[model samples]
Target: MAARPIIRFPDPRLRQKAEPVVAFDAELRSLAKDLTEAMLAAPGIGITAPHIGVLRRLVVLRLESDAAAQAYLNPEIVWFSPETIRHVEGSVSMPGVNEEIERAARVRVRYQDLDGVEHEEEAEGLRAVCHQHEIDQLDGIFWIDRLSKLKRDRLIKKFEKLQRLGA
Candidate 1:
């Protein structure tokens, strides 16, 4: 599969909610593959269908460079630990800038596989953060929305500067 072009930051599609995926067919698999390829090419550990302007509830995560990419369909965080942790988060769509954001330290996520098989998984640390981040994106919440207004404003300005510099 080939990497699809990623929708960049400030694109209105990034703010639009993704539709739930209903089919567990070859086309779905192909889209997952394309997402994985696009993520790898972007040097990002995670990405979603919406990153490429395809508003489907799908996410692909490769937590480590050598690890196999995992695809999740219609992923939702069913539970979140009261304990929180802060981690630097960035987006494939919003390149060249990142900010530290607080998120649940652990989470239980219910999601379907590429074949539409439902599964639940517990995640902690970085995995947990990624789940919440991606799920938020699926819900039309950009990562910066998690930050303080001052922080979000600063980050957006920085991102805009980078864009002007062609970074």
Candidate 2:
């Protein structure tokens, strides 16, 4: 497996909606492995295909304690709890910045596994947050999108300047 480069924010590809997987073939399976490697190289807990310019409805998530990686294809949130929790979230695409956001404390997600088997799993805490974040990527949304317009604009400007300075 190879580590794919992550596309950063402000890239137009990040705004495009991802396509669903039509078949769970060898290529898709290999892509899942590559995604896991990429996520691990980024040292991140979760990653979506869009981050690597695949534009496919795929995501890989591995918590610090997990021995095996988890792959989700065409994942959708079927249920979410009314209770919310706030946590500091960061993205490898938007490096060096983290912001606090409120998210559902629990969620039930349905998705196809690497072998084409469909499964539904309930998640909470960091796992739930990771699922939500990856699902947002599939929908062409990012964590910063949850911020107020003013805050979002300020962050864009900051990142833009950083880019200009090659920082």
Best by TM-score: 1
**What is candidate 1's lDDT per residue for 39-133, written digit by digit as tens?**
99998998989999999999998887435999999999889999999999999988999999999999999999987889999999999999999
Per-residue lDDT for 1-167 in model 2, tens only? 35889989878888789999988999999898888888899878889998888999999999987898899999999999999998888777877667788899999999999888999999999899989988998998977998889888888888878778886
Clashing pairs in 1: none
Query: Between which residue pairs do clashes occur in model 2?
Result: none
lDDT of candidates 1 onward, in order: 0.93, 0.89
Q: Please identify model 1 stretches exceeding 4 Å from their true place.
A: none
CA shift at 18, candidate 1, in angstroms?
0.6
Worst 10 residues of 2 by lDDT: 90-99
